[model samples]
Target: MPKGEGKVLAQNRKASHDYIILDTIEAGMVLTGTEIKSVRKAKINLKDGYASIRNGEVFLQNVHISPFEQGNIFNHDPLRTRKLLLHKKQIKYLIEETKTTGVTLVPLRVYLKNGVAKVLIGLAKGKKSYDKRDALKQKDMKREIDRAMKER
Candidate 1:
């Protein structure tokens, strides 16, 4: 599939507001049958979710994919940790980057591309209160500029 093309299922909208994203990579997810079905229905939440490197593999934690209603006894856990599929080289790079102070792996969004589940993970650094305020100010200024231009 082409880059950045997908049917988005869930997004962490607060990620941009709370963190300074440095880079992003799309990685595939390992999902169960019921979990995938739930994801296709957009019953997923990325808020409070993050990725971590464990034993040389990346795993996504805190992401919630509700069990499929029709799954019955075969349903997967809604809050189970899921593995993220990425190349060894990419995992190594992320491991090194995450070792730095304040650097973290945050899941920005989840989507389906070419009928496969994918997640957009971002390398981020925490933003201080002042940084958030500055961002809000810049957004307000941009909106005002756009409004003024429209009035012209």
Candidate 2:
């Protein structure tokens, strides 16, 4: 983070390497007290997780939110499907766009924004192996240029 910038609670590193994120949408998570407590510790994983729109609402699937250690029996499920809160219009748009061929709704990151937990969902399209290699090439080229400039 830049100096004085807001602290980042968590990030999904796999999302950047695997998916081609075309657009981002912020959605609120419906979390219980125990779940929120685990999030505060940054004990969360958005890797291998996905979001889907169903019946005009969104739900996150397969995300691992480590159970709150102190709560016995009442601890939130580690892999429960959590509902996402989004505006009606935004939900509608996401549903429509994701329904198109080769596109999916991928959860990018989960973080606290201004005291509220928000998920940065991405409108993504899967990349083939060649496409991934091409992306890596571009990134490597840019890094090389930066290194060259720094040593000058």
The deviation in Å at residue 89 for candidate 2 is 0.4
Candidate 2 lDDT tens digits, 71-145: 788898899999999999999899889888989888887777777778888999888889889989999999999
lDDT of 1: 0.94
RMSD of each: 1.4, 2.5
| Residues 1-152 of candidate 1: C-alpha lDDT, one tens digit per residue | 23756888898999999999998988999999999999999999999999999999999999999989999999998899999999999999999899999999999988888999999999999999999999999999999999999999
Poorest lDDT segment (10 consecutive residues) of candidate 2? 1-10
Q: How far is candidate 2 from the true structure (C-alpha RMSD, Å)?
A: 2.5
Most accurate candidate by TM-score? 1
Instruction: Give the lDDT of residue 47 in candidate 2.
Output: 89
* Candidate closest to the true structure, highest lDDT: 1
Off by over 4 Å in 2: 1-6
